[model samples]
Target: MPTHVVFIHGLWIHSAAWKPWQDLFEEKGYATSAPGWPGDRETVEETRANPDGLDNQGIAEICHHYADIIAGLDEKPIVVGHSFGGLIAQELLANDLVAAAVAIDPAPIKGVKVLPFAQLRSGFPVLGNPANKSRTVALTEKQFKYAFGNVLTDEESDALHAAWTIPGPGRPLFEDATANFVRNSPAAVNTHTAVRGPLLLTSGTEDHTVPESVTLAVVKLYADNTASVTDYHRYEGKGHSLTLDDGWKDVADDVLAWLAAQEL
Candidate 1:
């Protein structure tokens, strides 16, 4: 059987956003699917209309939801994720649940001590309000531009916001923010000793949501693990919207090339 790939999306973006990616991967001779989070509706409109299902959804629950989906695959598939989905990809790989993983602009896992100002600003929409921990939050067009499309043209940024943005559960952001203080935090990943499959972590240099410095810290956390492969790639001038914007193909093609180099 051809190698299978599972694409996991992050907060505020519906699973349907991955359709172009899925199509591209399939055309390249791989079987692919983009599965939504547990409570996600089938379409962007549907998800936007009824986002309460995602309220209070935390990191552990999201990880478990994807784990269950991976369990049913005939063979361990490669996982590719963005944002919180990137965090889930790492967790699943660390658990030996996937053949390999590519985390694009991933959220900071536990042990990441560098909290850049941009990251803080990006998360402020939820973190600014204590009550958001159990609620769902939506990003305004301005907020989306700042957090995800800062490097894109206003026209392109607004188009993406209108097409893909959805309500995101605030719980994961809350959990990630407090991960260092919480014991056995769900945002934690086993980066030190897991002799698992290869991992490729990518970052956009201009990413306001997850700055390159933050991803660099995560690379350091795995520095002791010489037994496993952990590669880092930096894309200059790219932003958090690298996975969904018009330039998404460049990022996707890079991932495809990396996977090919790994012979996966």
Candidate 2:
């Protein structure tokens, strides 16, 4: 079987962040695609210049974008997502588009509780202001360190900061924290109930954004597979930025190993 892989990136990041993972998966004979969020720029410089480019788009639009891609595929792809992308993966699975999926330190999808200190703090910049709901909020160096750069060296963190970090639409975060997230979205409640394919949840031990508590909370929402088919793994000394941090390759290796075991 030819397994394709689709990577859905989280908020504040474009699809480019998945380049390393895409390269790895494609080399193994799996096809790959990392579709951009609506109005997203093609490059980091362009992203910085037009941070609001994707602001007009909503979760429903983005979800449908991935769904369209999946519907066109000859074979179902193994979907991988982190943070907001994780939520998207669950949405994709709910739509029965992928064969298997892994969500890494994914953002909460309504009803899934546990507001970690880190997640709260990381979101404070935007959540504090009502006006931010329709605007793009940029991360300060400190915010970046606490949220995404904690696991990397200062140099590596600086490099990452310089290369790709940009402002993001605060509306989605607000949305996730408020209304529809709780009552409407497909991933509104634990994904295990809807997920038929193999699912692996990876949490970073040091991550505050999607802390271990949050990951476990998500696992509990699953109504079936109590025999532990839904594998949950935690990596020590890692942060929410596990997929983009210096040791990202190791994290990717673990994901690949799990996917391989499923033989998808």
* lDDT tens readout by residue for model 1, 197-250: 999999999999999999999999999999999999999999999999999999
Candidate 2 structure quality by residue, lDDT tens digits, 1-264 = 567899988877667888999999888788888887766788877987987776745677778888888889898888999988888887777667778778898777766667878788888888999888887877777777778888777787767777767778877788777733355754463454464677788888888677778888777766464533577888999987788877899999899888878886
Model 1: residues >4 Å from true position, as ranges?
none
On a 0 to 100 scale, what is the lDDT of residue 173 in model 2? 81
lDDT of 2 at 169: 81
Best by TM-score: 1
TM per model? 0.99, 0.92
| Highest lDDT against the true fold, candidate | 1
Cα lDDT for residue 156, model 1?
Answer: 97
